[model samples]
Target: MSRLLFILALFLNTVYSCEVCEPCECNVIRFRRRFLCTADCSDRDLTSIPGTIPSEVHVIDLSYNDLHSEDLARLKLFTGYLTDLNLSYNNITYLPAQSLSTATQLNVLNLDGNILEKVDSTSFGHLKQLHKLIGIHAKTFEENSFENLEGLNYMSIVFGSQEVSENIFSHLKLKTLHTNFKTAKRIPEKLLNFGIDTLVDIYLDVPNVESLHENTFSGLTILKSVTIQTEMMQTLPSNLFHSGVNDDRKMPVNLVTVMIDGVKSLPRNLFDKQQSLKHLALNNIEDLILPKSESQVDTLDLSGSTLYRVSADWFTGFKNLRFLNMSRTKLVEVNNDTLMPLLSLTVLDLSYNNITNLPDHSIQSSQNTIVAFNVSHNQIRNISSLNI
Candidate 1:
């Protein structure tokens, strides 16, 4: 009898048990004496939530399924245990109001490849604990679409329709945002008024934008980086980068990086207000205009521009400039006084230009601080007069 009992235990151990999440593969991950389980129901022809998913499941991958929008209502069964949900490439269209109201512990949600038309208010009101939201491509987001998502800090979305309202994101406290304006030509000033106190980085890919206003980024107090990539942008206002002013402080101090590509013209005093600005890149700009007043920019990249002759006054106000790159900018001559005011410059790149000569006093002022200088791929015929 003892030998028969041992044989039965061996048979049980050999057969895999999937009673926790039948029809889905369950993986148990052990971490610090804790067991976290994931249920992968992807690529299944599931029309609704599996009834066998255990309550302890933390992550669920329901991608490439035929689940309709109503099938998501069954998620309430695993309310507190569900942390991540990937509903990508599904047949979901409209999200019912309050469908996920009981999911208080949910953190991350992905809804890629869905043809969602509208997001009404209170749809995500109960998800106060959600952290990152990804792939929310909708035509319109109602006034309070993100009403109670107080913990949502990161988002990557595409505004598919051109009728997106200005206040669609006014309720979020995101720290990082990556948005693509599909058909919008210009971003309204108040479109990004959300996350004033917490936002750190923002990326805007506007393929059709033609111009930008001065107060496009006015309210944020702690924003650190701004990158705008466009193919049709032509004009920029002088105060485009004016930093947010604090009540107790007179000067702005948080903003540090600014990069804009594919622009035609830039107005004077463009960065005069950014006292803490450090790195600036204006690549592929057809017509470049240096700021008339002093700026604290440390790194400046003017590559792929249409500069024929670099003027001496361009670097006069850039006293704190360090790294300068003018590679691929059609330049004929870099006069002697052109870099005289860049006393703090450390690295200079003038490669791939039409320059014919590296004059003796061209970089004389930066001799003490300049460490790397490149003038390769130019029409330079004489370097005998240069000291180094």
Candidate 2:
């Protein structure tokens, strides 16, 4: 009798136990202590959700399936345990209304790589606890599309259409908005007309944007970090980056950072009128045209350019200038007293340049007020002012 019991246990362990998710080409991942079991049905050529998902599964991956209403309907059965739903790359053009209404606990939703040119407004309202929304190929946004997403904080969308609107960003609590566009000529003038002050990090990664208008970013109230990476932009119109004031704070405020990448040239007076602008980083330019700004920028980076020389008079405008970076710029020579005017400079990085020798008193005027100076990766032979 004992031998028979042992044989039965072995049979159960070998073939009788339910260890795999069935009815579809899938993989079931189980964790003993930390991870909840997950059903991965990605890239399975499945037109519908598997009929039999493991009962212990708390996460499902249907990202690459040709899912339809039937697949989504299966989710209502496991709504209690499932928190994440990945429907990316499903070739889905429309979302059936209330298909996930029972999934009130859905927290993360990824709709990337779908034909999301059309969608029902209330398709997302059922996900009250949803925080992160990753979308792709967006055509337009209706007002009620994101109405119930109160806890939403992180959102990144890839634009497939130029139909921008004011209500698109309204009534959300997003801290960061990363909008990457393909061949978008311009960001609609009133994209943020609702005055969403909670947004702090706004990244516009539209490579083909030709020009920036003076009122491009006019409605933002409290934007702290701004990054605009474009392709072959010759010049930006004046007042292109002047942002609106935040009424919540009585004191003056400037954006903590501003980064410009992949621009070929800078129009004169590019940074001229801004009051609170501080850190400025210019990258990946074939030519260098320093903008004339009377306002103070404590940190300035002119790296990865084709410039060969720098003049002292070009920096006389910055009053509170401190940090300067000219790395990887191929600057071989500096005019006499080229860096003498920066009285408050502490950190100067001239590494990765073709500089052979320092011109007389080159940056020597700043040694007393400077803290750390890096001139490594240069072809330096004469150290005129820097003794060591």
Candidate 3:
């Protein structure tokens, strides 16, 4: 009886020795195990990942599957040195908090194109060495979703027809961020809430914003350049560049250039106290009204605006002005006083207008300071009448 029992036990062990590989194409292309196992379960009809994945596996590609929150919860057994994880193009709606928090050494996490709505604050706290995060398509984010990730460098949030709150990205230390919103009505104040006081680049491409409140960008002191595109903005508030005026009673002075397109007109005293402003570009404006102030501006661009005529003394306060662009307007003639206050002016662009002739004293006031003049596509027939 003892010999018969031993033979039955040996047969049972041999039957289950080699695990049956799932009938998928990814399992056919086998490779040597570096640590324990490396599986390619992508493009298979996998409803859920097998719970027995070896901990020694380093690379796992589980993309193009029907994974959900429940399936992701089974990843708590992963104890290997997983550095890269691809879960893109899945049917995941919410992230499994327990599984993700246990994967401490995960560096790259790709969760794009999911139906995620909110990200828990402590979801990424365990990944101390995480470098990049690619899951921004959610409609909104929890306040603390990026609470303890101090080592994170890059993040991208590509939402699908959703509106993100202004304070969504506050207190993060990321160097680069790309956000696309469908109907974002307001620019959240949290965008300027980085505690570092400086950012490399920020691109805001919201198309539904209509108005920008005063002190909209008051926190970013070390910002070098800013580009904003929206369909509803028509004017700029007076204290738009002044940062944190209510809290510490200080202003942002490091701003260098401001480019605004698709506005109808500019309010009076638009740049009242912006002392450090250097370059300004205003395009696609049909009519412009200058504010009354003695502010100093270095460069100005009014290209592609339908400006008919600028009132005399319009540029009287800009004594340190250098470059001016007035290309593509409807001006037929410029008065002598309109070109009198530009003492330090150098470059002037008057192309694509209806001017038949240059004023007699237009170039007389700009003798040596003016170097380049673009007057193409105009009605000026003679070039000798003007003293450029």
Count of clashes, each model: 0, 0, 7
Compose the digit string of candidate 2's lDDT tens values, residues 1-388: 9999998786454332235666533333445653454667788888987777754356677887787654576666665556777889887776667677777767777888875665446767677788888874556556567777788887887766665555676778787788887756777766744445677777788787887666656656576778878895776665565433432322113577878888887766566445778898888877667666575789999888778877667787665789999899999988766776787888989999999987766666676778888889999998775632
Q: lDDT for every model?
A: 0.80, 0.71, 0.67
Instruction: For model 3, state the Cα shift of residue 180 in Å.
Output: 4.2
**Which parts of model 3 have CA positions greater than 4 angstroms off?**
1-161, 174-180, 189-191, 199-203, 221-224, 243-249, 291-296, 382-384
What's every prediction's RMSD, in angstroms? Answer: 6.6, 7.4, 11.0
Q: What is the C-alpha lDDT profile of model 3 across 1-388, one tens digit per residue?
A: 9999998885444333223335322222233632223456677877898654544344567888888878887677776456667788898877766777657778777887776766767556677777777765666577677776767777767654445555556657776565556667776654556734546445556667777766556666666555555667777675666533455634455556667677666776565566666887777776676535655668988888777777777887777788999988787777777878888889999999988767677766777799998899989875555566
lDDT of 1 at 319: 92
Candidate 3 TM-score, C-alpha based = 0.61
Ranked by lDDT, the better of candidates 1 and 3 is 1
Sort by lDDT, best first: 1, 2, 3
Task: For candidate 1, write residues 1-388 as lDDT tens digits.
Answer: 9999997775443222323576888877666785566889999888998987766677889999998888888887775767888998898877876677767788999988886787776567678899998888777767778777889999888887776678878888899988889888778777777767777888888889887765677666688998888899777765566533443322224579888888777766667666788898988988888776778889999999889898878887789999999999999998888998998989999999999987889988888899999999999988856554
Between candidates 1 and 3, which one is better according to TM-score? 1
Error of 3 at 195 (Å): 5.0
Every model's TM-score: 0.72, 0.68, 0.61
Cα lDDT over the full model 2 = 0.71
